[model samples]
Target: MKKKFSLLMLMAFAAAYPQDVKAPDMSSPKWLRNAAISPDGSQIAFSYQGDIFTVPANGGSALRLTIHEAYDSDPVWSRDSKMLAFSSTRYGNKDVFVISAGGGVAKRLTYHSAADVPTDFSPSGDKVIFSSSRLDDAASSVFPTPILSELYEVKLAGGMEKRIFSASAEMAVYNADGSMIFFHDRKGYEDPWRKHHTSSVTRDLWLFNTKDKNYYPVTESIYEERNPVFAGGNN
Candidate 1:
């Protein structure tokens, strides 16, 4: 009887004095997308909660670069690491826009009905290259379809956009000397929500020579390959 009474008194005392609870950390937000590390390897820019943010590559507090209500994503760092170009739906359809690394007014780079998604900045950082289905090249023999996208580049100063490649090139980037481009070809569209299945229209990586205007397949696998990149200065 004495032991039971002591135990009950201890339980009552513990229930009366609860431990302190810590608050949840909101710094590391979830569902971060389109993360791109700067060329200098100092900072990382990503899309989180419908806005763009930059944080130290080593990990630290995140700095919000954009606070717009419209959906903004696809952050691409310039070669110099001083600027960032991203896609935004501020004007209805997705269009390419550029902002400073430190954050400021975003300048619209492309204005077209077709969605312009910035893939990478030019080697000289003078222009921003993007993928769009606006039009097929005049010399292109492929049929006109929305599934296919063409590569186009608009000057940072903002002028007429010149079509660089007439095929469906995605995640395209230039080599060190700008002599070649590495990208993956999108043959056609597929239902992303459907179950994964192998098909003949799987994406393949390709290397394109700027001088000859010719492209060669880097991978001929039956499975899908994507986002090709050059490593260690080797073309």
Candidate 2:
């Protein structure tokens, strides 16, 4: 069952990012997606072929981690670069999991039967933030949903998850001070014909302050903006 779901996820992803995915050059054979630099900026980790792998920042042989038959992707390195947090479908449902950066057994961190995708790690490396449908009261089933995906944070040692925002967003990056998180928001629709349909998909960047519990638009343009990260300085 877990293996089947993994295949399904890969199919969905392929449909979504097919144009963006480029065939690897012979010199570098791996087709990488969602590559993120470790907090220290020393190494980079990314998902490829349903697993997480890391390589040197300057370039080197990719080291594979988490070999489960189920899907594993969206790898985020801890602040110290000692552990990696990512989402996997190995437990028969999409949930967040963590593993040592060097390589080790992946431990499940979330138990939502619905999808859970880890987006970022806090600056302190004590917690992980992800998007999930688990908190929806009407979402008894995973696939069909009127409820939007919300942002949540969970302790690395494992504990109750905390809801931080109510919006369907993706590719979140934390502020250096951990006071705010930036993400791209989008709405989904059932109708396939409408040009501006929910599924038509327009995204924009947003910033949510953890302390004030408020969300602010970061971009005014209608064009889809995604994966915003703080370049330098403490915010």
Candidate 3:
């Protein structure tokens, strides 16, 4: 029942790129991922070395935010760009936390037993969408594999978390207009190299319409596409 570590889990999510794409320069210390621009589009917040960091949008020195030993990543700027919300394991479990954009004490947002990782913020800046398995009955099962990770929204100021949809998703991100959410679901599969060894898996993009309360697949191919964000805007 233990969670299976597939390629998707290690790379975070699968993104479709041209087959001729060159491998990234992993040797450079400045390489980063999950780059989110500020609302004003003047700066970017990203994760590096297990903590969140910020740098000028035009490229400059990076400033470290959290100094905790636990893993911290997936940083997103609030709509107003006054604060930052991200996921961290500082509290002994992966949970969402918010801190001032200018740097200050971080505030814990979710208290779930499992993991609550915020993916993106609504355009209005009133809510945040995240993925978690906190509702699953972990104690009742032997291996406690994350059977399903549903998307939920909680007020940026803090309040009751409401389930937006129940599905086996990995990372969830809200669209620019806040009318829809895109996520990646773990489509279970069997290990090809080892016979009789089933493993937790995922591949496919799912779009959830907030207005209609419906979920549907955007693509049927087996590719991991995740951490999607609205590109090109006034910021």
TM-score to true structure, per model? 0.86, 0.77, 0.72
Ranking, TM-score, top scorer first: 1, 2, 3
RMSD of each: 7.7, 11.3, 13.0
Model 2: which ten-residue window has the lowest total lDDT? Answer: 190-199
Q: Give the 10-residue window scoring lowest on summed lDDT in candidate 3.
A: 136-145
Summarize candidate 1's per-residue lDDT along 40-141 as a digit string, tens digits.
999999999789999999988888989999999999999889999999999999999999999899999898999999998988889999999988878788
Report the CA-based lDDT of candidate 1 relative to the real structure.
Answer: 0.89
Question: How would you encode candidate 2's per-residue C-alpha lDDT over 1-235 as one tens digit per residue?
Answer: 9999999999999898877667667776567786989878888998888889999998779899878788888888777889999988888878999999999888889986778889888888889999886554354243435345777889989988888766666778788888888888755543323354232356678888879978898875645566787886555
Q: Which parts of model 2 are misplaced by more than 4 Å?
A: 1-27, 136-147, 190-201
Worst 10 residues of 1 by lDDT: 188-197
lDDT against the true structure, per candidate, is 0.89, 0.79, 0.75
Model 3's TM-score against the true structure: 0.72
